[model samples]
Target chain A: AVAMPAIAQSMPEVKWRMTSSFPKSLDTIFGAAEVFAKAVSEATDGKFQIQVFAAGELVPGLQALDAVQNGTVEMCHSASYYYVGKDPTYALGTAVPFGLNARMINAWFYHGGGLEVLNEFYKKSGIYMLPGGNTGTQMGGWFRKEIKTVDDIKGLKMRIAGIAGQVLAKLGAVPQQIAGGDIYPALEKGTIDAAEWVGPYDDEKLGFQKVARYYYYPGFWEGCAALNFFFNDAKWNELPPIYRSVLTSAAARANVDMQASYDAKNPGAVKRLVASGAQLRPFPQEVMEACYKAANEIYEEISATNADFKKIYDHMRAFRNDEYLWFQVAEYTYDNFMIRARARG
Target chain B: AVAMPAIAQSMPEVKWRMTSSFPKSLDTIFGAAEVFAKAVSEATDGKFQIQVFAAGELVPGLQALDAVQNGTVEMCHSASYYYVGKDPTYALGTAVPFGLNARMINAWFYHGGGLEVLNEFYKKSGIYMLPGGNTGTQMGGWFRKEIKTVDDIKGLKMRIAGIAGQVLAKLGAVPQQIAGGDIYPALEKGTIDAAEWVGPYDDEKLGFQKVARYYYYPGFWEGCAALNFFFNDAKWNELPPIYRSVLTSAAARANVDMQASYDAKNPGAVKRLVASGAQLRPFPQEVMEACYKAANEIYEEISATNADFKKIYDHMRAFRNDEYLWFQVAEYTYDNFMIRARARG
Candidate 1:
């Protein structure tokens, strides 16, 4: 009903496809892609629309990055670590064993020059990335039997992802890479001894509790698993500046909403899980220490050969140290007090 | 370069003014308003422009809500707690004594029905609100002297905000509400014995370190102070749907970026402050416990009379309890381990 501004009158109508690395059932993760798309559409008044396809619709989840890189898709939502086979450096883009947590990663990416460093590496592959989602500290995978010591890992076969699998292999465990849909059957049929998908919410969705009795805590490999939206560099550069800003803002909203969804949903899921006869356990200190040591050994070994990996790894580690120093003093202290008070009640 | 879509061709150009309750010098908090405005302009191709004014440009900081409500400005950026004088229910929109931290509040607002509940109350005052910024767990304050027990608080005059002041008054401490710029002089001239601001980064700017040698931490009263963008309900309803979505996305970006900026900057600021001879101290357990007790007593009294306050307060407490239970398991243990390892190194 109002007259149009000159700039708005010249805007272009655009449409694109987005493939997700998650299933539609795990709404928290997959839903983030939808959130991004919806925001873009709403902000542009449907002038720009993105169609979202769940994993396997266009390609397998693990192949999401390849699809974008090869021009099979213009953009896709997936974890950077899923492409570690192409470059170990990819793990740093998502997370690494004993890497920064959700808050720390966000701080590093947004203000600590992490995005610049990461984009420099990603440019080599013709991909542009934006943080799309995050699952706060995930639970340790579901295990058929308890893990109390490093020796327990010596003969275990576990389904894991990315660099974490390599870290486990160093400790004598046989690591298996399985798709999300296949993890349950693999564990049920004795193909795998343990498997981890995500935290209580997603883990509950996969029915892992029915098959595995011992559900563990502190997914060490993924202190926080951040997902990304990968845009084909050529396609990204072709967009009008206004659309680019809209996309960036949309991705940022999805990033915060995903974590908030997980934090709010996980509490109730954990309660339901425990009531379903799932035995909750924390990794023994001995196992955690050994894994921590082993993880560092692998990082140093990789850093010696790969310049990109070494550069990002060193930067992230430095940032992580400072974040911990500050967190211990105030954030941690306050949370610790609240936790104790809740327990007392 | 490209032809405009039909919807874009009819879009209207709109300009509005925004007043902020913070000065320009406190960039992390005040700058969030700038960030939101910039994003909106960029996304709309300058068709929708918002000009942001710092406190006192349009109205004094404390009058931000009044300016928006009475149509002096279309919108204003402020903390909901700043208007507790209008109604105690205002405190729940930002935070309350010993309430949820930054992450928890985001989770509660976005997913646990917090935004809906708070907006129901906000609508009564002709305002529409969206979370715009957050300061992660803040420092307690700058104190002229160490407080060892409840006795030390008996005659102390502290500059505090909102409901925290009432909680402290119950403990025999005198509470003073002073504007941000005046705090340094108040502490220096013995007008107030202590003052609490956001955190290390903001506190360092206020030169509180020069006035008070003792810097205490874990500001229990304001665990995480969230800021909001308040729009005049009539103006909000008149916006094009596209403009509303663009504004919402922009505010969300500002919300996350502010916290990220704080987390990234505070560590360096803390190091600098300590190097300059600021003594870091934690509140004694006895005093913390006394404050905690007093805070709950005050909440109970408020809930007994205010139906809106009781409804939201009870919901937040229940959510807070569940959140702590989950946090202690994975988030806390992971952070605690990382903190100790950092210490050992």
Candidate 2:
């Protein structure tokens, strides 16, 4: 009887295209798309194949969301914050300055009703989304000179992205939106005084350590950058239930794997970067306080004008507060002890 | 041609029995097995079905690994530390005293060669393992009295599991092994001085707060407990590539989701536990340091005798050290700031 039902529910072959907002050379992020595609194919016995395209093969990197929305490609893997110009709500889908970290966000999305809240907003844009990857906590960026105070940020031309750039703007810095490929040249030519990309592995690949000697910790802007897979609403609905289930599982696999890859690789990369003369520095407490204040101000301003942004922001902040409370009790204490023990050894 | 290949690769009708070393009431842990089963069934179009059995249904919870090894069950969901009596090396597969945290362990398992190393040792027992779930950093336990110093631990009868019990033994505490269902009664009847179960979510369900009023935090012995899916090696090899891929992806989904569920649920449960008269306390630094020292002594003694234990311990400790170097720089600083801000609010 089980065999008969399985035969009746025979799978149909389906092929789709996935465009990523990252170049293939940055395998940790770009490779997530490949990982997703491979899992889908394997699980479906090659019946469901998704061809992955690095940024620019189908369209420019920034235009990936547009491509998925307009049906040029059935889906895309990109950072949700890249589309913040459309609405600040988009930033919540990825990361915002002083927001939830990697673990907190995953918990919120998978168990705390985050996906439902986000999908409800995405519906109007003709897209459906699933978390695809995370970079963990990213480096603040590479800087040519040390910043000792908030005053140092004044008039500084920095290549940053999303609402973080807006937060920095409130503190008198000039934020430039430069593509990843161009950040190196911009920093080298003095076109930008500083640039923030990912952590050590990807940053070292781009050779930011050569031009900028001062490397900062904890990119306050992007605490943990969550990459998402956006699918055309109609196309997503058209899939058989089994195919959808497979894709969801595959995306989850990519989501967890990306962070694991980063965590595994960044340790070696950080050591290499430091050995190559990149000075590791923490942002001054005064500067961090100022940025925290500015970030909150920006959130208040956005909340005053956008209901969608306000709803998600309130929900996430509540969840975040509770998360930190629990973390402080066990996770933080255990980690602090271990870190100290490791340092002593 | 693609359709022809897909049709030819029709999935086989297979049924499996999965025994979990968790009770049905503890949904977060037991629920992971259900999550894995659902994914397998959905991906296989109902052709592949896995029937899940809670602890004591088919065999005792502690015997889950033996069931898989002897082919009494195709697989089992359990913690490797339960089998530490067989080999101290088994503790490394789950969590040992002062082991890696949730994110760190996941990173190590998936990317930092943890699975390869673990499977190598597991092979001798005719078992193959995949990370099934993690509970994040757990609460210390419910204590009938406060533990203010190393002196307080002397002659204390505590119910703890695995290597932690041995570590406590070095500190003059008498450790008792009790099943999940028996811990509450032991604590209530004054048969045990203290009992460490899971975090607030599961502990509350077991009503430990009613018997033990002093709730201590930061389960140092298990920074994170990683549950595992132990499959019979021969049966695992016999599966088609498609089935294997599906199972791998499904297990990953469960692995990520379990922590998410716990993270989302624990915060609320903790508040309720405290509200209901559980006085939360942190283990004093003096006691922590003593336990830490004792744990290392045990490690040294075991490492000298067990080659497998030494090899994995050295590798994991090296990885753990490097991970903390990175985490302290960014992750810790950022979280410390946020926690302070939340407190201020």
Candidate 3:
């Protein structure tokens, strides 16, 4: 049925406090706040406003979970997977190696019980959840040297996150949890041999291309990496129905916008990066296979230890399987034909 | 600095005709097409494939002026704005009068501009176009009802395309020409509301939400409008560069996966709309009067003018200067403040 008729509803003047898990330096991601706040205000005709606070303005970027959960801020924009330490299920909310592409992840969230299951998990942390944005398929990692085999990953420190880090750890890569802004310096200063930012567009802007000559590909870990917007459960429930809807809609829009920005900007940026002498390399196939092997093993381990993680992962895997099975025949056949023909032509 | 990606530059094979005026739908817009296509091919390991079509697939939609100007696309996904009558610019796109709601317009395009813009415009004379999708914006048709008095609209159909038919004749409304969407529609749709569309998210989606909407003050011209992909240009650049980008990108994404798709499956679609409807709405007292007045004068003149409605009435006057000037301030003020605040926060 439709929402309450406009006449039947008496809108409320609500003020919201949002704590971001990021500094405002990153506009594409931080742009979410600008769009969301502006949208919330416009939707409410300025009657409802969400005063957004930057990561450090309220708390440490990493502390957004506690702040939002504790109601220090009514909401937050972050990578849920970053909190895998608290609940491995969060990785499914974001992405894990070999997971669905950004588009598939969104579909899963909207159609595959992803939002529902992820929300349930957020409730435990005292918040409500929405997928705000995604970094479409990420690059593997920025490396100091060419990776010839799985052995190349041994003991190398990397500023990485999500399940991919663990997968890398199994392959002997020392994973470090660092923020985006911090990655370049850490890498440039030699604190880490490699790091993985997003694709060419962002990587070039961050100047990762300047320092790292051997950039690897197939960010298998994140075909589509999602950013999450977390609203405190209590605060969320307090929103006027319209306000809630606005937040949801805005988040979804921002989700697409973020990725689109990346796509449009990436092509031009890649052209520039190449012009600037960046050396792009593919992750060794063996390394990819090994990472895949390690990833499954880690997924299994987390599932065994955490029921919540196992529960969601099981569902996600099932859907992936069903989806993959269907794609094999129709889409796969045609896309294969097109790619080859286009090249040949 | 660059991906100079040689490994995966491994272009897959395939050929096909796809006409669209959209970027790859990222999880929201055209994301599904991507997921579907990727699943198919990736599942097979380059065995089969489907190509895509983006705007300018073969030719450009607006060039229906150009297509008839040349001969393009077998099919397309475009909104009326691109052509604007071939001459009046009235046919420029679709959905004038308080325009169509995003959903209803979808109904219309599949049903209205659906056949109108194409057969009525693109395909009718020759080429083909279809209603691919829409994002719901449709503020108070923007000329707004708030005019100080009706006399204000003398000779003003305002650049408003499509529905200008009713108002322009009724008042001095003059329609103008502009395009966005690589000619999928007008990237220029924003300031016209003399209106805009999609939603704040997509408005902001297309970067218009930031420019006007009186913050949603008015814009009855386009309530919910559709976007189409135009096609056929010299047998489509003879099926290469553009045709290639399109067939591959469009078949898999574009209009079919655009804002409409996002609006449809977007879980919190309405939620986000309300959140960012952007203080938008019906025009004020005098403003609408001025629009009516101006729209009529322009309509009368055009009704009697050249075989093709000489001198397309470019923009809504009374409020035109005021609106543009208003935006210069609002945009600058709002943008600078927001940008700075975001930076600080």
Candidate 4:
């Protein structure tokens, strides 16, 4: 027999506020938090409601981590890399250059001991993290010129971030970390030669096509960028078991929904971009190869000095190696043939 | 401000029973149902409990859909394709030959209108469906001898089920659908020339490797097989909104956890299978090409007579086409490079 809700009963209604690292205009990203909140509210019979505050509504986007840590906000939907200044390990929780893609990251976190390892790191920060959403593999960036070879990037000035920016700097590119809103103008005024934003869906909204005609893909730096719903430790522990379950499931649903929205919407965006005369390009083999070399070097150097970084990095690398092998044999082979076959038909 | 849960209160208690199409021995498949039940109970603070019954304990495995539909059981966890006898449209809820893989399937269902379309179809059967789990990509199967060309499949006997079996029949192979436990013995006794179960993890447990030396990959027929959780319409609607939300999130979590478990476990299973003298091989390109051709033809023939099948198939086909194109430029390219690089290292 199923449990029926007791009617005419009184229970305390709970409400909370969440600060998002993204503005409402980027619905796909910010919308995941909204989706989580609404589902949680509905699941709790309207007893649990979380009001979402856009970036700068309550605190600047980058400071979301601080807000949650100090209890300025109970929770946040934000990217992990925004707090890399605290520890380089923060970047691994999100995405790293040449790292796992969206599916692989999910596999790692949920199955390959990644969640436990990362949570141990988060425990020190006085918060708990749950996967909020993911943007599937991102595009390389919009460029004003085609990069024909490795040399093309040597003197290039580009806006990139986190470990990726560090990797590019080693390859002789001057990496500028600019705020998202300022990227288009930087590329337009020749202040920067290129700027990497998210993939087609988000990049199109930023008007990158208007300034940069060449669009390179497989942003090796961000194969997949994962966003998290973070809860303060004491507040999280105080919640009833049922509400905790709601939060867990709601966040997981949001995780799947966000990526699906991106995947569904991105194809149309790419089509529109091409129609607008945007050229799609793959980063030249020479450049990809050089970046690959630099990324590994950077990993090796960081692993030498940071114990926590080394610990998680080593585990992730091994897990990633195994994932790549398995996917190549099954997923890759099937996809490669089918894409070509469908095109032929 | 964050609201805390009020203590010293009583809530109603509920219990449920889940009928599963899989036996207890197959933990990964049957275990997902257990996982969902346990999560629900815990989330409800013991106010809800779901006792699980293995196939045949209550009803035969294939009868799971009937049990749920009739309210003989409140819910059931099984593959949608198992009930294809009820309607060919049912197969679309699981997998079809050369169809979307695991990640793409998630995208289609959650965001590409697959869920809405399929749920409408399910409403006729008196149940609501939620994605329960996925076996990422299954292996082609175990072969007693090497298959070098399409011709080798002409007279072979294989134990493969669903639409894939029909496609194999078109290619001149004799198809047999046997219970999982019986396949290994049949393959060993020369009753069947080949047998396809799941991937390495489950296949190894069944000792398929000991009897068959050639293990082929990219089960083109089942690029990914999705299992589903079905709740009886009457019983489902009677639950409180909070309970419904619990089920939604719980099922979603199970959906993700199942795939993660397989992905995490399969690599080790693969290595062990090779150690046991199982020769790993990809199905010859010629065989794959022939199967692909047959699959498309079968879809066309079925679409002509089955309106429900045609409607969903067309949406899925268009969605699959777009997904393949987007994945090619980014996911595929990056994977193609990284896999080779990792192997080389």
TM-score of 4: 0.96
Candidate 1's error at B68, in angstroms? 0.6
Task: Please write out the lDDT profile of model 4 over residues A156-262, one tens digit for every residue.
Answer: 89999889999989888999989899998899999999999888888888889889999997799887899999899888998877778778988888988898889
Instruction: Determine which window of 10 residues in candidate 1 chain A has minimal summed lDDT.
Output: A2-11
Against the reference, the lDDT scores of all candidates come to 0.90, 0.91, 0.54, 0.88
What does candidate 2's lDDT look like per residue over A249-288, in tens digits?
9999999999999999999899999999999999998888
Candidate 2 vs candidate 3: the TM-score winner is: 2
Query: Best candidate, DockQ-wise?
Result: 1
Which residue pairs overlap in candidate 2's backbone? none
Output the worst ten-in-a-row residue range by lDDT, candidate 4 chain B. Answer: B2-11
Question: Lowest summed-lDDT stretch of 10 residues in model 3 chain A?
Answer: A329-338
Where is model 3 chain B poorest over a 10-residue stretch in terms of lDDT?
B325-334
TM-score of 1: 0.97
Q: Encode model 4's per-residue lDDT on B1-345: one tens digit a residue.
A: 633223222234677789999999889999899889987877666677888999999999999999998878999999999987888899999999998888889989998999999999999888899999999878999999999988899999999888999999999999998999999899999999999988888988898888989999889988789999998988889887678877888888898888888888887788888899999899888888899999989999999999999999999999999888788877777887788779878
lDDT digits (tens) for residues B1-345 of candidate 3:
755332123223443333444444323434433433443243223322534444355555344335332433244444556455444543434544332333233333332223443344444344445344454443333333234444545554344445454565455555555443321133244334344333333444453433333433334444335555444544444543422332333232333345424433432432344466434333444554444455545555564754333322232222122222212211122222222322333
In the range B220-243, model 1's lDDT, one tens digit per residue, is 887788999999999999998899
DockQ of 3: 0.02
- Candidate 1 stretches with Cα past 4 Å from truth are A1-10, B1-10
2 or 4: which has the higher lDDT? 2
Instruction: Compute the interface RMSD for candidate 1.
Output: 1.1
Interface-residue RMSD per candidate? Answer: 1.1, 1.3, 23.0, 3.0
> How far off is residue B160 in model 1, in Å?
1.0
